[model samples]
Target chain A: MKYLTYILRNARRNPARTGLTIASIAISMFLMMILTSFFAAMQEANSASRQYNRIIVMNANGFAGVVPIARVRQIAAMDGVVAATPFAWYGGKYQNQRVLFAQFGVDADSVFDTLEEFHLPDDQLAAFKADKAGAVVGPKLAREYGLKIGDAMPLQGDVYPVDLKLNIHGIYESPRNSDQRMVLFHHDYLDDQLRLLGPSSSSGSSATQPSGRAGNAGIVFVRCKDAAATAALCKKVDDEYRSTDNPTRTQTEEAFGQMFSEMMGGMKDMVFWIGCAVVVSLLFVAGNAMAMAMRERTMEIAVLKAIGFGKGLVLTLVLVEAVLVAGLGGALGTLGSKALFDLFDVSPYTGGFLPFFYVPWRVALAGLGVSLFVGFVSGVVPAVMAAGSSVVDGLRKVV
Target chain B: MSAPPSIELRGVEKEYRRDEFVVPVLQGLDLSVADGEYLALMGPSGSGKTTLLNLVAGLDVATRGQVIVHGQDLGRLSEGQITRWRADNVGFIFQTYNLVPVLTAAENVELPLLLTKLSRKRRRENVATALRVVGLEGRERHYPRQLSGGQEQRVAIARAIATDPFLLVADEPTGDLDRGTADEILELLEQLNREFEKTIVMVTHDPLAARRAGRILHLDKGRLVDDVINDSAAAAG
Candidate 1:
């Protein structure tokens, strides 16, 4: 404890150098924290999709192609399948085209059966079933847009060309916070509105609507009785549609989420590599700073050694100084990132991709671990040099 | 019959190697200092006076022969053990007054005691007594750069003796000071030797500083050629 003050004072010997080193470390650590948090959020989203015994059936051509709604009945009647629901991407905007959220047009009758994680009240479900133009919003989305039950929510569709005016029937809660950012309504209401707009209406433009049918869906979500049987069931469903005119691609919900993440051009791996680069750069920066400090203190180190301080003690003193700087920078970067995320809503920025973008405890702990690693790596060379110096020769050094 | 010598050097040889060249510093030198003896080593440049002091203080190892201090053979002890021995037994004063610039006088004086298991309050008391002994009681809060050359040397001396070691080794203790300040420092060393009964081996080229010592030895070519006793100065003091 007595020596700690001496170490700290020595670190402050060159205030400008120390300050710049700390700032560099802080910036790199902040970048690392953000990257790690982003990767963690992606993993959380993928993991959330894995918890349910569900499979996603999309067009073999990929997510851009529409799946026929008539396939939902065949999928539900397949072996090991409990129920299936057709979910169409509305890509709707609220008030303006910029206010976007995850608004999906789903089969209202089979949604709860397919997605048991969403907890909606029985009365609210009955009201949504009774009203053709009824929508159920997640609690997070409701709080974000200041929505309440019984309010009419108007959405401007970007992809479908139909403007929707639906009543907010209920706000559902889920175990995962990311799951509570969705707005789901009946696909039947969308098809009925499109048919009323006539084939010549702008709302019924051929570019916006799927050809050959008014009831086509973007994808079908199939629920299975056993999660372990998902791979075989997916194969069976894909095989059933393989001989048809429009083949289907069937996969587990987790795989579907993974494919979406991959469609973003390997963003998760890019983030991981960026995190690695930041850590390496930080190591070099901190190491150079410590080496410079050691060079300046050569005589002082010899003085300490001549005064009977052990090599281990001198080494520890230097290492403690390095760790103090790194730990302070790490704490600032990580806690600062948390505060920044909490102050702003980033879900809208992600375009509803990452519903939960906050830093998790694991990512924060990993950031701190990286900081400690940087400190250790930075201090090792200088600490060894200080400890291994010859006292007689060191005393002869003028500076 | 008397107590064993405070420090003993037997045929100690020291050599420095630069690449393939082995440059000899001290060759087959033998010397001893009795307890409470004030000894001075005088020589020209490169006479191996500082080298001998370093060997006695356990800062450097002898190339051959034994450096036994306070009844323990330093050459036989490992590097770590010698370091521990030096902490417990030897104090050093440098000509440059190598006080850690970042620390205050009190902190500098308190540095050696940090190696001990002493409490903070006990260490503070020791630093206070050391500073007072050097007549810098109120200057304890001043940094080395803020102090005069004489004052910085006094703080360095205080740091050397703060741990109450068995022997004090000084290398050109007043070489960097003016005549007046050098005399003051020599007087302080005299007081420490007389009052505290500290065995001191000092190296210097200053003849006046050598006169203050009880005995002086002159070295030439790594071997002692002359030994003189200052009887008149001892009687006068």
Candidate 2:
């Protein structure tokens, strides 16, 4: 107990240095905690975005191109294909405001019935089917645009020459990762609208022809009956479309997310390395603070030793001061991270990816553990210096 | 058949090395102090007066021979054992009054008692008694810096006696004080010796201070030159 008092007195003697050490420790620990939580959240979002059984059948080229609508039907009739829905990527500007979202034309009724994940309220579902130019926007998009039920919107096409006047029948909220921040409406309306906006007399292709260029949809989403049947079903579908007029490239959602993660190469490594650097720098700063404090108290330590304080007791007192500074700093950083979450709304990359932001309890615990370990590492040298000092020499030192 | 001398040194020597040569301080010195003896050691600078005090207090070791204080040979004891023995038997008063800066007068007095098995209440009682003996009962709560130089020395003396050690070793206890304060301090030491029968070995260069002791031993070049018993007139004046 007396030793604890001495430690407190020592720390209080240099409040500024102690406070700065604590702040540095706390801030770095908090950042590490936040980074780890983001990593965890990203892992969760990546897995959630791609369901194992759902296979995406896009053009043989990549995600940007489109496949014929005829191929979508053919893929749906395959052996393990429980259901298939065609998705057409329609590029358009909302009210010329440069607002962007995934404007997709899907067979609303069949797609909703086939994919168990696209869930909406019964009223919204009914309203979506009742109106011809009706659309159900993802909840995040609707919130961003202030679009409510029964509101009408004019969307100017970016790819095809057409203007889409659509009714916001209902807003859709989805737990599935793919359903976030998208706009889905009936495919028939887009197909009809595309014919009106295309050239009246093109050289070789007619707009009315079903197998022509106007009839092409972006991709076919094949929802498997059982998640385990994905590999076999995918193989069968690829083989059915092999050497056909238009070949298909099929992949699971996880593979798709992995491709995106791989695209952001060296970014992950940089963040990890920076985190390590921060920790190392913080360790040195904390160590220096403890050493300075120890140096200042040389006389007091000698006095204690001469008066009968054991070397072990003196060492413990110095270490306690260091640990207290570091531990409190770690706690402060963690609390600061939590307060940050309330003050700022962190959105995923601008119109590109969904960002995962959260602070896990494990990260907090690990941060505190690191702080304690660094405190110990920083304190040992000074503690040994104090313990090994000669009491006679120490007493002779004029304070 | 009488009890062994309270302290005995036989052929004790201390040396300090300079670059390549050894400078011997005390060479083959022998001395004995009996129980209840108030002995004053007077010497010029570099005559090894302080070194002798350190040897007696177990703060330093003799390069050769034995230093038997309270009938225990210091040379044979381990460092830890020597420390414990010093805490148990010796009280040191330095010229600068080395009381801990952080502690109050009472806390400084209670320091040596911390090494003992005494209860908190017993430690407090001992500290209070020691302070009262030095006539600083009301100054117990004051910090060392708040007191005058003379008062700080008095507090240090109170601390030395707090543990009730058998030997009080003072190295120029009145060296840094004014003449008036020095006289008062010498009077206090004489009172402690006569009233409590505490054996004191004081090392000082001041002849007037030496005259107050029951006996004075003068040293020159590490050799004893004079051993005189002071009469009543000399002791009082």
Candidate 3:
């Protein structure tokens, strides 16, 4: 601490070079902080999705293909099944803008039963079940689009080719992050709307709509007695429908969430590789700067040794200088990133892509640790060479 | 009965081995200086004046024989002990006046005192006193580049004496100064030795600078070839 001024003034010997080195470290550490935050958010969302022990029934092809709606009651009545709901994707655009939130047609009476994590007002639930056009949105969706009860929502359909006119009757809260970005309306309302788009009716659009797919269900969400019953229930349901016209495939909800995680696995791999590259590049940048500093101060180091500083003390000074540079950069990157997120509202830009996105304090701390490690490793070699240099050879410069 | 000589070199032989060749710099030699003596070593390049100074200052060790200063045999001290010994006992003045360019004049003088366990206030007082002794008290905040060569040398001298060491070894202390500034530096050295009783061993190529010392020894080919007693130096200062 006594020599801190000397070490710091030595760093300021080349202000531009030191500034650039710090900036580079800050930028890379900033990237690491963001990436770490994103992974945490992703994992948290996935963990939240697994709070209920449930299974999903979809057409054998995938969720893109629909299961028959008739399977709902049969699955609900199956042994070890608690409740079941038809969850059909209604990929519609709101106000002609492609707002990227999930729009699903679900059986209101049974969806809250199957996905037990969600809560809504009893009166709002009654209203949702009474009116075919009544809809309920998650809390985040309501906040994101500034939705309130009694507001009208007009969605132009692109998948089913049937537009929906829905009135906001309720806003639901959920423990799960992804669930907070969903809009669930009655599946029967969608079927009825599709019925009006028949060949005999000229109702919503002039474009020809696909026929005879009105009773399709994107998925039949089934809650089991517990996690242990999910696999057996899924197999029983799949086996029960194997001989039908629309053969079904089923899985535990956790497994279904893992499928989406697998999709993100590719992107996560890319991010991880990019993070590794940034660290390596930062090390080289910091190491080169330390080496250059050592070269410039060769005589200065010799003078320090001659004036009574031991070789260990000289080595420590150089290493500490390097660490200080990298540590400052790390602090700027990590703390600055956290502060930036705190200062801004980033959800509107995300379009509900990442729910509950946040940079944890632990991630910031880890980032700082990485920066310090980078400093230590980079400075060690240069410090050794500088400390080991002979005072006679160093004073040779004067001659 | 008087105090033994402050510095003693008995049969000191020094050599450097580079690429498997032993290049002898100092042959077996004997010399001594009294507690308050001011001595000058004059020689051409490669004449072992600087080598002898380094040995006497504990900056280097002899390949053979003993180099003693202030009653401690330097060759017997361990590496760390010798460094501590130098810090407590020997002060050095280089030809370049090697002040750290980034530090102010006062900071440069305070450099050596940092090795001691002195409190910050105590170190500051010592620095002020050393700077005052070298007549650089008011210029403590000035940097090396901002000061003249004569002033920079004064700062270096202040740094050397900051710990109040027993011995001072200056290798061409005024080599970079002009004739006028050189005389000023020589007089300052004379003051340190005269009024303060500092034992100074200076190496120089300039004959005029050599005459400023009480005794002068000229070296040729690693041996003392001429020894002269400059009786005029002590009277002038």
Candidate 4:
């Protein structure tokens, strides 16, 4: 404890240099925490999808193409299937073009059963099942548009020409952040509207016509009776569509979520690489600062050695100083990042993919681990140099 | 019947290498200092006086021969063992008053005691005693820069004797002070020698400072040339 005062005072010898080094470390660690949080959010979405025991079967041509609704019944009757729901993307603007949120057309009767994470009251669930134009909105979407049960919400469609007027049948909540920014309506309503617009309204040549036929759906979501059977069920579904006009591409919910996340220009890998670059840059900055400090304290180190401090003790002192600097920076950076994330909503940055983006505890811990690693790497070279120099020669130095 | 010599250098030789040349600093120098003896080494520039002091203090090793101080051959001990031995047996004073600038007077004095297993209270008591012995009892809180030349040297002296070592080695202890401050420091050294019975080996070029010691030795070109006993100065003391 007595010696700690000396080490701290020595660090303050050049206040400007020490302050700059600490600031650089803090900023780099802040960047590292942000990158780590982004990856964690993506992984969180993937894990949430896995927990639901859901699988997505889309057209092999891609999500733009369609799957037959008849496949939903076949999937539900499959050996490992529990329930199935058909889903289609409705890129709608609420009241104006600026207010954008995820709006999906789903088979409302089986949606709650397939996605057990979405929770609504018993009466509201019955009300949604009974009304033809009823919609279930997420709590966040409901709060954003001042919606309540039985409130009428209108959406202007950009992809399709028909405008949708829906009654808010229920407001559901989920533990997962990604699930709380969406609105789900009956897929039959979308089909009716598209049919009213005629067959020419289908923009893509590959897009299937909404003809109220048994074989017509944008995508099918199947819930497996056992999550471990997801792989086998995916293979079975793919085989069943092999000879059909539009063959299917089937995957577990986790893989489907990962694929969508990757579709955003491989951002998960980019964030990981950016994190690596931040660590490397921090290592260099910290190493240079420690080296310069050791050089300036050469004479003092010799004085300590002469006064009977062994090489091990000297090395420990140097390492302790380095760790102290890095630890302080790590604490500030992590706490600062936490505050920034808590104050701002960064969901727009993720393009509505990760609706709930915040720094997780594990990411904070990893950021601290990186800081300590930087400290260790930076301290090694300078600590060895200081401890290895000849005491006589060191004392002979004027400084 | 008398105690053995406190320091013994038998045929000590030291050499330094400059790229390709082997520059000899001390060659076959034999010297001894008895217990409680106050001795000084006086020489011209580059006469190997400081080198011999370093050898005696166990700060450097002899190229050949044995430097047996307090009956332990320093050359045989590893560098780490030598450092521990120095901490336990030898106290050092430098010409520049090598006090760690960042530490206060008491903190600097407390440095050598840190290596010991002494408790904080005991170390503080020892530091206070050492500072009082050098007559800077109330100035313990002052930094090195806050003290004058004489006071800084006194703090250095306090630090050198903080562990109560058997041997005290000083290299030009008053080289960078005015005459008044220098004489005050020399008087302090004389007082420590007479009162505490410390075995002092100082290296200095100042004749007056040399006269303060019981015996003085002169070195020229890595060899001792004179051994003068200061009986008159001793009588004055």
Best candidate per lDDT, number? 3
- The 10-residue segment of model 3 chain B with minimum total lDDT is B228-237
lDDT of each: 0.85, 0.76, 0.86, 0.85
TM-scores of all predicted structures = 0.89, 0.72, 0.87, 0.91
> Candidate 1: lDDT of A67?
76
Residue A243 accuracy (lDDT) in model 1: 85
Tens-place lDDT digits, model 3, residues A1-399: 889989999988999999999999999898888888887666666666565888888888785466778889988999999999998878899977785778889998898898888889899999998888989998877887899998998889887778899998999988634557778898998988887767665434332234456777888889999877888988898999999877888988767877777888988898889988888899999999999999988878877888788888888999999999999999999988888876754655686566556666778888898899999989999999998888878877673
Residue A165, model 4: Cα distance from true site in angstroms: 2.6
Error of 2 at B81 (Å): 5.1
Stretches of candidate 1 off by over 4 Å are: A70-84, A109-127, A138-151, A174-181, A197-213, A222-243, A351-353, B19-21, B136-149, B178-184
CA lDDT of B83 in candidate 3? 80
Q: Write the per-residue lDDT of candidate 1 for residues A196-272, one digit (tens) a residue.
A: 76655543544345332356788899999888879999999889889876688999998887776677657777878
> In model 3, which regions exceed 4 Å deviation?
A48-61, A67-86, A109-131, A137-149, A170-181, A198-213, A220-255, A345-357
Q: What is candidate 2's lDDT per residue for A87-191, written digit by digit as tens?
A: 887778886755456787877776775566777789888988887798988776776778888898778877666667888887765663344678888777787
Interface RMSD of 3: 1.2
Q: Give the number of the best model, judged by TM-score.
A: 4
Sort by TM-score, best first.
4, 1, 3, 2
Q: State the number of backbone clashes in model 3.
A: 0
Query: Which interface RMSD does candidate 4 score?
Result: 2.2
DockQ of each: 0.56, 0.22, 0.57, 0.59
Model 2 per-residue lDDT tens digits across residues B1-237 = 998899999999998777999988888889888887888999888787777877887877999989998779999987678777877887878788888666789988888887788888998899999999998989988988899999999999998888888888887889899999999999999888888878899999898888888889888887778888878624563
Better of 3 and 4 by TM-score: 4
